[model samples]
Target chain A: MRIIAFASGKGGVGKTTIVANLGIALARQGKKVLMVDTDLAMANLSLILGMETSPITLNDVLKGDAGVWDVVYDGPEKVSIMPASLGLQDTQRLDLTKLPGIIKQVAPKYDFVLLDCPAGIGEDTLAAMASSTEVFLVVNPHSLSIADALKTKIAAQRINAKPVGLIINMYAGLKGEIPERDIISMLELPLYGVVPYDEEVRKTFYYKKIQPVILRNPDAEASKAVYVVAGKILGIEIDIKKQGGGFFAWLKRLFSR
Target chain B: MGLFSKLAFKLLGIDDTELPAEQIGYIKDISKEYSVPEILKNTFGEFVDSLLHKHLIEGVVVFKENSLIYSSSPDILELANKLYEMFSSFKRENKVLYFNVGSWVSMFEKDEFVYMIKSDTRLCEFELNAVAKDIAVHGKNIFLEEYRKIMSFVKV
Candidate 1:
């Protein structure tokens, strides 16, 4: 399986959101995708996906009480999520011996393995990187953010992991001045695509239980942008019109088939 | 240089890349965890955290005996490739610069006057901002003469 992880040097840069959306985009392309919440500490991917109380979690798999499939949940767009429990936050750091074996067991089953890593560099973040093949850095267009990203690049090289590219999140077109060139210069990372700041991403978790923003607005700027990146990561050509559908429609078809 | 090579890429100017905030902080934090200099720790942490919060830093790592030991995220690999491209323009001109004057910040003692310079040369960076400053008292020759007159009570 091709494993890709979403990570940031600092917190609150929309790492989890990208993971949730990107996984759906890839899965919608007919690729069996598995989204792993390696951020054992602040296990919040579930909240982003709107499944706060999952039946099982990564802790169960780590503790040997359940298989990886048991903790896996269907995400908004049929993406499989290996969740982390709120109660097992401390287990964020992977136990080396069991990790390779566990990853080996499940890696062959999926086309894409996307890991939602926690914020900051700790034992947990490193372990997540170790399990993946490529890494996607998330950044905001700010000097301080660019500076941290500069340093984060060094950290990645310290370990022999491939730095894939970057995603600019919460992209604000202030007065039509995107500062795209400045950010590109400062962070010195490849510009994959920009995700415009959208209130719908936050609202979907509350009133509507949508699988992903793509299903709601396939043509939305942010959704389209995310799909482009997902397409690049999975190396697949995507036609959004072919994949746009609500959750119930998918459920009905699943039951019928 | 072996230790430097292991970390050369992680630090600013150590390789042909722009150091991400997370990687910078991770290196500093890890270095400090093993008794690295306090100056690097303080400045690096502040700089890295600030960038990270702003989303400038995408990935970071803390190495243990080389290899991809630990990281802020698995995506650090992607950040590295981008950084390689990001700093390529400045790579040829990168250099290790030193300051002759004492630091402008007053938090450090007057006797602790020391030059602040960029240690990383992988990227061509020539600017250094004054992080902090403090005021100090100065006296002229006339003031010294007046002070001597005022010291009449002394056994002259």
Candidate 2:
């Protein structure tokens, strides 16, 4: 089984969203996927998946109260999930050293295991990366974001973690944003895929009806981009027809006229 | 008076009879080679003097390559060595460790280097770990910049 950790240097970069959607996308391709929320301190994967309450969580496993199998919840699209507890006290008593053993126990049951790591290179983030077979860095197009991602790459390299590639999220092609090509060059990592900034993504989070955009709106520009990423991960070429004549495209045509 | 006698009489206000021959011989032997003790004293003395001048630290000790290189207070060397050993073991286990004793907060980096910053100002363990993370991630030059920025805020 291949285990990949989705990590970012800064928060609010859509790391969790990418992991959720990517898991669903991979599951849709007939791959058994396991999505794990390894961000123990601020566990939001459950909230993002509209799973506010779970009978068992990673906290119980870390605290020696429950087994790993007890916390595994069947999420959408045949993706198994292990969500972490939201207790502040649990963060303090967590034994991060046990994370690798925990992942090892369950990794054999799935084709792909995606770990949603916390922001920044803390001990928890290192533990999660150490447990994974490869790491995928998520970053925005801002210079600070790129700088922090470079630091994350360096940290991962120091720990001998294999960095698979870079995922550019929330790309809007806006002014003052760093270009994707430059980000790839500066980070010195291959571009897996770029997910565009879309209004539908905000609506999903705002409404707390967290579902993969690929399944929700397959025609969305962002959804198509995510499918490309998932296809690359699965080593499958999906025939995605380019859909044009959106409002932005129409506005560009009007301006050009 | 002769040159040696004159120098001794002027510096010590004592004749050659008062200065033992062994003591004079020992001084001559020390002057022939570069004195490591003197150099360590002068270098560390200057460092302590500057910190005192700036009122940055009450005492400090430094270790590199598993040896005590410089120290403002000799009494702290034993404790520093112990802490170094502890941090070394932690590094072997792939863990970063930090702690505080009284007014001084100590940070142990992955390169087997330790820094003691004297301040009553409290910083959470997360912030301390973040400092260690930056050093591990960005290398020494960038870590030094971050160290300087932290010192700028904490230095009185």
Candidate 3:
């Protein structure tokens, strides 16, 4: 199995959302994907998947109270998930070192293993990176987020993890936003894909009906972008048609105007 | 006053007649448990809790030896244990571990024991690093004083 970890130097960069949607997208492409919520302390993947409480979580597996296989829940879009415990007290007693072994045990069963890591370069994040074969750094198109992504890249290098590339999210074409080329130059990582800012994504969180954008609204610009990223990862070509009308259609509208 | 008013007073620079009694009581409870100074407890707890609540830093845990002294949230003891091991190894190598991810900064000091400070948002890396250095330089005295206070009340 190809183990890939999605991590961000900073928080609120939509790392978990990417993992959730990308997992679904890959599943749609006939790839068996397992999305593991490795962000133990702030376990939100389960919530994002609309399974706020699971009887068995990664916490149980780490504590030896339950096996990893026992905690695998059937998430939306046929993607398997090993959710983390939501309880605050449960975060304290985890053995993060058990992650690699758990991944090792489950890696052979799936085509892709996507670890949704917590923000920052903390031990939990490092452990997730250490266990994964490749790391994908997620960042927003902002100086602070880009700077943090650079640090995260360095930290990943320190542990000898291969950083696959960068996935720029929340691209709104704002006036002061950093350019994609500059981020690539500074971080020295190839651009995997860019997910545009979409209100549908915000509504997903606001309404608490956490479903993958790809499955919820495939026509959305953000959803199309996510599909492209998933396609790139799987070495498949996803044809996303441009939205605007062709030359003849444009001419007709102009004449009408 | 309510918690929101207190938060507004502190975060939004709003004026209030008095601090929130519930918040103050919560800080006092933490101060009693950790045996740290009330002022320090109140300030650090509020800062850390605000970050966690905002999802800035995933979690923060402080422990001496095997005992957890403080944590920003619950269910993160394993993270603390792993950090302790990693920092302990770094300490053995006569090195400190520091890294900045996004806006978050984490620093580990291996003096008498391992002390870790982690946070993101409202503080840049330079400022957070300065605070970490200060803690490394002078934290032992404060921690020892708190430990002494706690030991005095021990039944054994």
Candidate 4:
């Protein structure tokens, strides 16, 4: 029962994207995975997994209105998702301290439990971090992002939830971008993976279905990098599952930037 | 601080690792019916609904000993955590606690609990005293109603 939180000190570093793709990749490797949208306030893991209106969400379980198992929804391959509620009213009267116990109830059944944490270190964010066994900080290649990730790392340590590693997202390899080695040194954590900035990753959200990049176009740079992260976690090599659309697939990725 | 930790902090122009927004944002536990803030809020809300209906008061938050029982806004919830230290002073002489921090605030106690009322305008100290008396008795009814709901609905 390895419960891990994918957190970003600042917003928009592809935290949700990495969690969704990694969950799918792990599931493909014959590992039981459960991805939870712990962000209660602004949830998107459900959207990427193609579950827009999840009738039962983590909100219900926190409020003690529903059982933890009752809210678990099946995702791509063998992955199970406990998505956060989309409704505005779902965030009300939530007792987040009960989260650890709720995760504990269902954690034994799965090999991996991935928490999609909310941005900013508010009460909601703290609750998610406290509920997980370890935290993985996500940052972009820049000074401010690294600075924020450092604060997130310290916060995780104070609560006794060790921040195990770092994942650099949207690496464009442009000038003025902090080198990956510098990011690792400043954050003082091992680098798990680096996801290259890819347009195909954006198409998953822009297109009709709102699927994960790993499923929509496995050959995409962002998808391959995410699989590598998943493979490292699962201790196995992953061969991208290719669904042949060939030239038309290239056309789809090109236009959906 | 390590070599890189100090470098990142210096480069970003921030010295403190603790961000103001990163405080522990919840009551330590919820299964203890006496400690749940929502139940206290709902119970006190019912008692103050008439004043709220008349627009005489903006809102009311209830706190029992240390735990904040209820607050209308999430922003105000953090304020409750800062208030426990001040509550001890109210036990001896300060029958009615008043402060003006943007919103007019008043706190009066009844037994082990304290009720905080927020108003747009400054309220007369004597007048607040009388209202506090009425609430002390009325707070009992609201407690019964909330407790019944919690007993039936909540497991934790």
Candidates' DockQ values?
0.02, 0.01, 0.02, 0.02
Q: Model 4, A2: alpha-carbon shift in Å?
A: 0.8
lDDT, each prediction: 0.57, 0.71, 0.71, 0.73
TM-score of model number 1: 0.56
Taking all chains together, each candidate's TM-score versus the true structure is 0.56, 0.62, 0.60, 0.61
Residue lDDT tens for model 3, A122-171 = 87887888789999999998766766776677666545567888899999
Off by over 4 Å in 1: A88-97, A175-178, A208-211, A241-257, B1-156
Compared with the true structure, what per-residue lDDT tens digits does model 4 show for residues A43-86? 88999888878888899999989998999998877799999988
Tell me the lDDT of model 4 at A5: 94
Prediction 4 TM-score vs. true: 0.61
lDDT comparing candidate 3 with the true structure: 0.71
Q: What is the i-RMS of every prediction?
A: 18.5, 26.9, 17.6, 18.3
Q: Please give, for residues B47-134, the per-residue lDDT of candidate 4 as tens digits.
A: 4564353325676666764556656456666555555457555555546667777988777776666767778876544335434544
True contacts kept of each: 0.00, 0.00, 0.00, 0.00
lDDT of 4 at B52: 50
Candidate 2 lDDT by residue in tens digits, A1-257 = 99999998889999998998888778877899999999998998877777878878998898888999999998987889999988777776777778889999999999999999999988788888888999999998776677677767766664556787999999876655677777776667799999999887776765435655554556678878888998888777866553233667547634643
Report the C-alpha lDDT of model 3 over B1-156, residue by residue, as the tens digit.
799878887898554343234543443344333321211223554544433432234665556665555555566566567767766666644344664544343545444445455555433333333343444443435555555655665646
Write model 2 residue lDDT over B1-156, tens digit each, in one string. 889879887798553332233533443343333211111112434534543323223554544456554556676766677777876666534343555666654644445555443335443333334334433443444334445555667685
Chain B TM-score, all predictions listed: 0.19, 0.40, 0.40, 0.52
Residue pairs in clash, model 4: B37-B69
Model 3 misses residue B125 by how many Å?
24
Model 1 Cα shift for residue A19 (angstroms): 0.8
